[model samples]
Target: MIDPLQIDDILASGGALSKYFSSYEERGDQIEMSKLVLQGYEENMAEVIEAGTGIGKSFGYLVPAILHYEETREKTVVATSTITLQKQLVDKDLPTLMKALGKDIPFALLMGRSNYLCLRRYLDNTVSQSIFASDPTSEDGKLATWVRTTEDGILDELQALPRGVLKSDIASDFELCLGQKCPNFSRCFFFKSRKKAESAGIIVTNHHLLFLDAKKRCDNDEDYTEKALLPPYNRLIIDECHNMDKNATSLFTQVFSYYGFLWEYRKLVAVKHGANASNLITLAAGIVKGKENEALDVIKELESAEKIINNLNSILVMSLSGSEQRVDKSNYSFFLSKYSASLIAIKQSLDKITSLLNSIIGKTAFSDEDSYIQQGINSAICTFEGYSSFISEFLNIKEFKDKVYYLTREKNKNREEVQLKISPLEVSDILRESIFEKLDSVICLSATLKVDREFDFFRNQVGLDQREILSGCFESPFDYKKNLLLLIDNGKVLYKNNQESLYFDHAAEKIISAVRASGGGALVLFTSYKMLEYVSSKALSELAGFNILIQNGELSRSQLLKRFRDDKDSVLFATQSFWEGVDIPGDSLRLLILTKLPYPQVNEPLFKSRCEKLESEGESSFMMLSVPSMIMKLKQGLGRLIRSKDDKGVAYILDGRMNRSREYFLSQLPPCNCPDDFLDESLERRIEDFLY
Candidate 1:
């Protein structure tokens, strides 16, 4: 067992940490959290800690984790929600701790298998030309050069390649990976990363990969403790625990995209017409006793199936016409019922295609060449079966009564497509059985884990019963009252009854005034993409002097953020994702604007189902679920301001509903300077003073 005193000594004021980080201060919250984490590890119990920002949460957990592993030779896995935090731990925190401790600790980073390039696939596509015809002087040759010269066959390194080339042609296919039988398995980059992770003292990964690993273990009934993607470890740390529920739900969900099916169909067609097409036909002839008529009939049936699938796709697109808005399952029930005939037609077509593919496979012998064709056929068969099953289940609501089904429209390269998604009503049971029950110890930490100074909502959401797990909340070290100012609009025209245009105009005007008064360095966060676009279009001419960078605009996210930071007098408009995991310290960010309350859209299927479930259980869905969820999001958005003790800024809320929900909102937020007259000249002057 690790000594608690050793961990405490390291996090003390004059301890080893201060030697490397010159600005490090011994924070009480950090020390307390470290001690609790150490106790959790030593006692082999679950811990839920809400370590506020600036507590050095990473170090707080890292110190105990490294010490425990070094002393006991036990492996620990630290999972985070975003790549930014994962990189920070690997690139900054771990190295700093190693220096402070004066010892080398073995650690590795592991991602999903698709992130790495499979050498076998690359070789087959380029050299054997088994999948597609390739030209030596074209993009195929470029990939060959990259494969040879590159030491680590990770796809992220091949950024110079043309778009869609790597994803479509080179990336590893989960269904196609032959594992140990592959000729190039000895030099696989994904396996290398996995082997490193198996032996490393600490494995750092994101929550998605971690949940996926757990999902694999859950799916396999046998003992996966040794064969799981992640090495068997006793202790687990999940940072950004607020996102755990959503990530776990996503892991357990299934999605079928129209574009995805079309992409696969196109690939099948390409292979059928390629140079090797005759070889496959010959094999089919051999299976049918050289009956040329039968062989020709098989090919004809393939073409017929393709046409049927195409027609099915068109029918699906037509069903979604004029239904572009995101609709809850309850609201979409009538529409889907009205189009039951079309949905049933899709199912019938899928079943017909699967039957044809199966017949061809059954007739062919398992020769090497025939097996290659069989693999592709089997994949297509699975795709068709999956589509058929989904449609069947969707049409028969009784079969999926426990699941939340929803539909939404998405755009891919300016072409709109519909997506059908299904998620569990609650992932708590899954988490309880798959994660908490299997691990020896688990620590879940985040800055915004509590609402109204209680963790009951969060605890219930993440499947932690208060009787079983120890929980605590820590306030931030920074003085919010002294350093931050919160402003709420007191206007009478609150966002109500779908008056989006009026709200957008008012929000755009307020944003322009705030940005101008602050002299730029403003970050305006919107709740929806439509609102963001509306405001951006309206505010462009009004704020002509300042540089405005909109999210998903011409520039990428990283590029936009870089430009915003470099240009001091600039405003950035972003939605959803920008709410959290963004760190812009110092004067680069002077003002933060929230155009609306970050509430989950009532039309969203998952949100609607969760709310209904709560209501069924005799709970107030608004206070218990919606209010708490929104408060956490609000905290994340507000956290963008005042990253450090010396940093100062104003967090402005434009939602007029704050007037009625002021108590609930204010109680969850930090210190505020709410002027009686929100639009008065004095308020603008105060903002100017704060920025300058």
Candidate 2:
């Protein structure tokens, strides 16, 4: 029976791992920050933790939450950005804390449904020959046979098999899940995981699932959805709080694909085969036509309309590609236009059907809600509810509608060859009310929270009210000045400062110079995938005898990390995913080259919307979305360099914006009392000097 004061003593004593891990200087400010966070959780108030480098932030907060959970027997939901931290907590950190405290609490890992194998999909492939055409006796089919005999249904277990044979061959979307009606429901791994999670005292999940649940709850009041799986809990602790807005935005946006539509259309045709074959086939043809596709069954007209849609989709993909500058040219504009038009037509068709259904609804003498009339109401409502809003948004972008067209690939059975439009934008207010407002307590914790020394930018974008915001800063346990050389070059060759080609070559050269100087333990980070690819292609043959790991160079994160660790002379060129969540302790990573400050693409649909909203409030969108996000990411990248006390490294900001920008990113960044001469332009040798 330990007392609260003793608990405080344990924290002060630095627990068991303290001796092995780096020591944190217990400053008054840091202690106060830790206290505030603990109090906030106790009082059920929203809190933001901006723990800077050297502040033992992870354990500082983890200790209190663990203590609270132990006392009350309540669950503490810890959400992290990467699988690595999730593994760390489950395997390392939590165990150390538990052993120190002599307490064993229940915990469970909750992940997306896709992470688990679909028993139904596996069973169907085994039982049905008509469903999948290839001979079951063949090599591929023989492998499927082996899977049925020895399938554990865990994603990690499945990975042991040949790569393409696993996820590539088998998957069942939730909509197609058939629930209890499915024969394999009793043996589904997803359900088994959910059952365990529902009962566990402490649940660990990623931010993606949390946001997915919140959005799914608002959109569909269904139990099998993301929100329904969440066990009733009083408090929520978001670990990678910086990514909340970006993840939430992605959750709310709906995207329709040409391949998906075509597949569904074919399925519908297949189901109504034989006597109905000719008419259905004709209707499907019309559905492929641009103007003819107005009605779901308008065969000739749909065929003509689909042609027009395909034409527009092609143009839009090309035009939008020019603006966003990512490799995958997902013609989002084409989808928006065609879907909007289709929605209008769908509504009209459904409206006519509704009139007929209403006439026969009660006349059929069906009283149950699932009856014909109720069924009519149920299905038709999905089409009519948001029809007007989608149409209005579409009409507003009428000018870009002309550019919408299809990008088709030749003989690609695996991929949806027909490129479709999608709306990639932020959905803040919706997420805030749906998830944040409903939760009793919301805790957003991260190493990088305060950008330019203020949480207002992140707080606003995440839809948290300023008055409700309670923030704290826990300084890290590492010595930043001694371990890190903060290098900010005032070079004119930056992405925003010059032509695309000019900046690429300039950035590539700088990266080469850093790699050569460091003898290669470096990570060249890029905001855009295109830039990463460009720099990678240029560096590939140029930086020979050095292991160059590029983002898209057929290497998984784990693979790249292994390669980098194996070779002292190696550099990893990475983009969005690698910008953060990378942990290279010691001298494995000695330098970080940030190609540009990460800012939300202005052309992205959600970005445009947020920008307008900010403009209405007389605030700069760049400050709200751009600067804060960049600062958090920059801090994350910087933190990756000096993972432990012994690790020494340099972080180079190639983009002059970090130096020129009016202290927005710097003020919010981790306070590193860098040497006065470190940022000197004349001290060209300083970077090399620090490396040694």
lDDT of 2 by residue, 1-692 (tens): 22445334555546444443465334444455556667776777888887765565656667667767777766677788777777677767777777766677767778777766776555434233434324555555554555566433545433233333445224544544555655667877777768877777678888888777666676775432233657666667888788887776555544333443344333222232233334323333333344233334333333443454455445545454343322122544555554556545543543443343233232333333213223323333333334334434444554332122222232233432333333444455765766667666678887777765667777776878633767776677677767777777666666753488898887888777777778888888888777888889988878888888887746667788888877766898888788777777877788888888776667554455556656777988776766666667777777778787788888887876666753545556555645544443433466678877
lDDT of 1 at 350: 67
After superposition, candidate 1 runs with Cα above 4 Å error: 122-161, 164-168, 222-224, 271-337, 359-374, 672-680
Query: On residues 255-299, what C-alpha lDDT tens digit does candidate 1 reach at each position?
Result: 666666766565444433345544344455455564555545645
Clashing pairs in 1: none
Best by TM-score: 1
Provide the TM-score for each candidate, comma-separated. Answer: 0.89, 0.75
The whole-model lDDT of each prediction reads: 0.76, 0.61
